[model samples]
Every structure is written in C-alpha cells, then in structure tokens.
Target: MTLPDFRRRKAGNQRISFVTCYDCAFARLVAQTDLDCILVGDSVAMVVHGHPSTLAADLPMMLFHTESVARGAGGKFIVGDMPFLEHRKGQSEAVSAAQALLRAGAQAIKLEGAAGNLEIIQSLVEGGVPVMGHVGLTPQFIHAFGGFKVQGREDAAAERILADAKALEASGVFSIVLEGIPATLGKRITDALSIPTIGIGAGPDCDGQVLVLHDLLGFTEKPPKFARAFGEVASASVTALRAYDEAVKTNTFPTEKESYA
Candidate 1:
C-alpha cells in the first residue's frame, strides 16, 4: 500500500511500528512481524560499518543496504534514507537520489531538515514519490548541530521544532519522525499534527514509535540511552558464534549423519 494509506491508518489512532534493517536477514525477520514500515537508516554507518556517526554513510552504502532490505521485505513498505550530501546539491539532485531509491524498491524516501528541504520534498511529492519527514536530532546535521545532542531543549528551539513540524506537514509529507525531543514538545507536536508522529526519543505520547533493529536486539555495544533491549541477541550471537568455533576446532561439525552421502 501507499504511504498515504499508512498515514490515514495511523491518523485513525492505529499505532505504527517501524524497524530499521540493513540487510536481507533482518529484513526477512522484520517482514515476519507486524511492523508497518522498515527504514533503511544511515544509522547503518554506526551499527553495521562501525562508523562513529551517520556522517560517514554515503549514498552508495545506503543504496546497498536499501536494496538488501527491499529484497527481503516481501512487499512490506520500505523507506530508504537519503544519506548525507545526497540532497544538499539541491532539488534536482534530491529527486534523482530519491528516484534511484524508489527504483531500488523503496516505497518512500526520508530526508533530514525542514526549511531547506521543503522544495525537495515538494518536488518528490509532485512526482508521486511519498516522503517521510525527519526532524529533531537529525544525524545528518551532526556537524552543524555540534554532535548528537538533544534538540528542542530551549524555548526558541522548541518553538522552531513545532514550526518545522507544521511546515513539514504542510509540504505534503505522509508522516514525520520526531527524534530526541523533549516529551512535552513531542506531545504538543503530536497533538497538533494531522499526520502521525513517529518518535525515537520523543516519548510515549507520539502516535507511533520506531527503533533501530540492532538497538532493540542489543547488538550494539552501546546504544542510545533511550533504546531498550527487547532481546539479548548480542549475547546470544556471541554464544552461538563461540559454540560454532569450538565445534569446528574440535571437528565436531559435519558429523557422519550430518553429511550428505
């Protein structure tokens, strides 16, 4: 289904859950669940490629992961993130990047920022490509924002955040992802918008929630403070890998009964 349909569903008070996936395996697992969307986030820079931040993720890397997720999504809606610098070249560049992602099987595209992005978003929307708006703690602007700090903490900042949220909605975005904002501000934005607000560190009052898949699985050695581990996959993965190594060293694998005749 189109993202607009999903937005309508969300507006009817249905909570949507989005999960991040960087590869086909995780995308397959996500498809088995009831997740409404899968975001091929540039956070893959940190979680998969061992980068210190998302700034290190380039478009080719993002497209690689986006295609992998798309292959395993099994028809689920996929949103591919426009990596840093992909859209900074202007509206035409943004459309080209977004079009490449759509051809790569993404149902939608997400870009950071609010002010400089309205034209890009408008262009994409006009071309029948759904756009998911992301603001508050936009990792792409880590350099400008001066590191991964909490946004909307001050009065002026909070007002700007609110204004940005409204402006994004006015630009025909299907939904907005509010990240790392104060709970009160998140709640107010949620209350004000017709489109659903998907929160990452925003709060429980948002219309829906999203988390990086690795963060939820505890695969990251140090996830963001707001991330809650729903499973000990990290520990389990280590144990399983260790066991496999031990079995191989001991010649315990490929047993007689386990081998093909």
Candidate 2:
C-alpha cells in the first residue's frame, strides 16, 4: 500500500494488515500476499540471529535486513525499525540513521516511544522521512518495564500513553503502533488520532493490526497471547523434512525417473 493509503484506509473504516519479516525470501512471499506492509523489525535480532532480545539489533544489522527485504519486497511499503538507541543519540544522529535506513530501502522508519524524542521525530518528518511511532509496551524499554508486560493499564499510565500518542501525531508521524495496551485504550487512541493506529496486542479497535510473520505462521513455539497462528508451518516443515530424511535413508529418493536417464 502507498503512504496515502494509510489514511485512506482509516477513513474508509478498512482494517490494514501488516507483518514483520526480516529477509528477502520471506519478503518475496509477503510481497505476493494481500498484506499491506512489511516491517523490518528489530525483532530480527531475536527471530533471525537467535539473540535473546531486540537489544542486540544494531544499525548495521537493521540495515542489512532492510536491504535484503527491499530487494525482494517488490512494491510493498517497507518500514524499518530504528534499533534501540539509534534515535536517542541526537537529532543529527537520528537523521543520519534514518537516512541510512531509507537508503537501504525502508520507505519509513518505526521508532519506539514518543517521550524525549519528539524534537528528533519532528526534524525527521520536516526533513521528509516518514516516521511511524510506536508506544505502549515498547520492547526497547524491556528493562525499564521489567519484562514484556502490558502497558497503559492504570488510569495514569493510560492517560500518559494517550498524551504520547497525541504528541507523536503533532510531531508528524504518519501512523502509530499501539502495542500491549488494553483494547479499550486502543479504541480510545484510535478514536483520538487522525492517523492510523496499528495494533499489536492492542485489540481489534485499531485501524489496522500487525503480527510477526513467524508468530502468525506458527513458527514461534510460544507466541504472545494476542498472536494467532493461522498456519502450522513449523510442524509441516519438520514433517516434510522427516519424509525426505526417510526417503534418502531408504534409497527411495532419486530413483529411476528421478535420476538422469
């Protein structure tokens, strides 16, 4: 979907579909699907490289994945994550990082949280970088949060998140990802924002919903409670491989017609 489609979809009351994929192979598959966008998320550190968390994702790592996804994503709108502190360093530093991400093929950049980064976000938007804001259970603040827990649960915290969402919109983000917040709060923010709200564990009231490709495909052994696995890819893959292994062991593969005549 084009950038304008985000708002148009929201206006039309249509729900957007977004999924995160880290590499070209899956990106090619995602491109062929009806999914609206692809995010080269920092979750790559955990999903692809076996890191314990997104904290391991760095500029170079995100760049590499963004480049790979862009190469095979066709016309899919790609949003790359600004790994960890990439945006907190300073305005110039954030712009430089965003420029690199854009050059590496992200049409937009998704940064976690709105507090303490409004100025930088405004500068990026004014400079013409499409920024996607993320708040409420930002994974980058996992330590501060003590774990991957729901955010904006209390009245005070909910008000803060609502305020942050407003601030982010004022800073010129095209859309915002409302994550790990209560469904009511998600609807509240969605109603409050002029731009689209993409939900991840934030509930169905959002303008759109996003899921990790692995989680949706059942590759994740233990996905978040909000994630729904629509396909049994991991188990099917293992079953297929086992069949191949048995065929090879029994010399039942590459026989007769399968071999060069």
Candidate 3:
C-alpha cells in the first residue's frame, strides 16, 4: 500500500495489516503476501541482533536493514524507522537521517513520540516526506517509562497520550502506532484521530494491527501478551533441523536420488 492508502483505509473502516520485517529473506516472504506494508522497525536491534532494547538501533543499522528489505520487498511499501535520538539531534541532522533512509529505499519513516518532535514532523512533511507517528508505549522511551510497560493507564496519562495522537494528526502523520495501552484507551485514541491507529499491545479496536514478524511466527520464546503466534515456526524449524542432523549423521542425505553422477 502507498502513503495515501493509510488515510483511505481508515476512512473506509478497512483494517490495515502491518508487520515488521528486517532482512531481505523475510521481506521477500512478506512481499509474496497481501500484507498492507512492511516496517523495518527499530525492534530489529532486539529481535534480530539480540539487543536488550531498541535504543541500540543506530542510524547505520536502520539504513542497512532498510536497504536489505527494499531489495526484496518487491512492490511492498516499506517504512524505515528513525533510530533512537536520530530526530532529537537537530532539524538538519534529522532530515539528513531521514534522507539517508529514504535514499536507502524506504517509502516513508516512522518516529516515536510527538511531544518534542511536532515541529520536526511538520518540517519533514513540508519537505515532502511521508511520516508515521508512534505514541503510547514508544519503545524508544523505554528507560523514561521504566521498562516496556503499558502506558496511558491512569486518567492523566491517557489524556496526554490522546493529545499526543491528535497533535501528530495535526502535524500530518498519515498514521500512528498505539502501543502498550489499555484497550479502552486504544479505542479512544483510534476514535480521536482521523489517521489510522496501528495497535500492538494496545488492543484489537484499532483501525489496524501490527506485530513483529518473529513474535507472530512464534520465534520468540517469551512474546508479550498482545502477540499471538499464528505459527509454530520455531519448533517446526528445530524439528526440521534435527531431522537434517540425523540424515547427515547416517550419511543418508546424498543417497542415489539426491546425488549427481
């Protein structure tokens, strides 16, 4: 899907399907499907590189993965994430960082939080960049929130998050990601914003839903409650690997039909 599709989907009440993909192999697989879009999320630091948090995702890392994803993404729209603090530096730096990602092949970029970045968002949009805003449990603010906990649980916090969503909408974000908040708040934000809300841990009432590819495929041993494993790929992969090991041990892998003259 393209940038305008995000708004059209929300207006038509059609649920958008977004998934995070890091590399070309997975991007190729996702491209073969009808998924709405692919996000080369900062979560790659944690999911693919084994970092404890997304803060470890630097601009270089994001560029590398975004380029890889773009190569195999086919016609899929790709949104590259602005790494931690990349946008906080300054207008010039932020735009440069965004330029690099776009040049690397992202159709758009997603950034976390709107509190201190509204002007930056506006600047990027004014400069003709498509941006997706993310609020609620912004993983980039993990330390500020004291961990990957639910946000907007209390009345005041909920109000703040709702405001953030609206401000982002005003700032021209085509869509926003609502993460780790109560179901009621998720619905509240979804209703408040004209742009689509892509929830992850935020609940099913959103205009759309997004989950990390690994979590959705059961590759994560301890995925969060909101992530439902639609497939047991981890276990299935292990079983296949074990069979291969056995075949190799028995010298049966290159039997007559599997060998060349």
Comparing 1 with 2 on TM-score, the higher-scoring candidate is 2
lDDT of 3 at 72: 94
User: Candidate 2: RMSD over Cα atoms?
Assistant: 1.0
**Per-residue accuracy of model 2 over 1-261 as CA lDDT, tens digit each:** 888989999999999999999999999999888898999999999998998889999999999999999999998999999999988887888999999999999999999998898999999999999999998999999999999999999999999999999999999999999999999999999999999999999989999999999999999998999999999999999999999999999999978988886
TM-score, prediction 2: 0.97
CA RMSD of each candidate after superposition? 1.3, 1.0, 0.9
Over all chains combined, what TM-score does candidate 1 have? 0.96
Kindly list the per-residue Cα lDDT of model 1 for residues 1-261, writing each as its tens digit.
466676686668888888988999989998888788899999999888989889888888888999999999988889999998788897778888988998888989998889888987888898999999998999988989899999999999999999999999999998899999999999999999999898999989898889999889988778787799999998998999999999999999969999998
User: How well does model 2 score by local distance difference test?
Assistant: 0.95
- Tens-place lDDT digits, model 3, residues 11-119: 9999999999999999999988989899999999999999999999999999999999999999798889999999999999999999999999999999999989999
* TM-score for predicted model 3 compared with the true structure: 0.98
Q: Count backbone clashes in candidate 2.
A: 0
Error of 2 at 224 (Å): 0.7
Backbone clashes in model 1, listed as residue pairs: none
Candidates in order have lDDT scores of 0.89, 0.95, 0.94
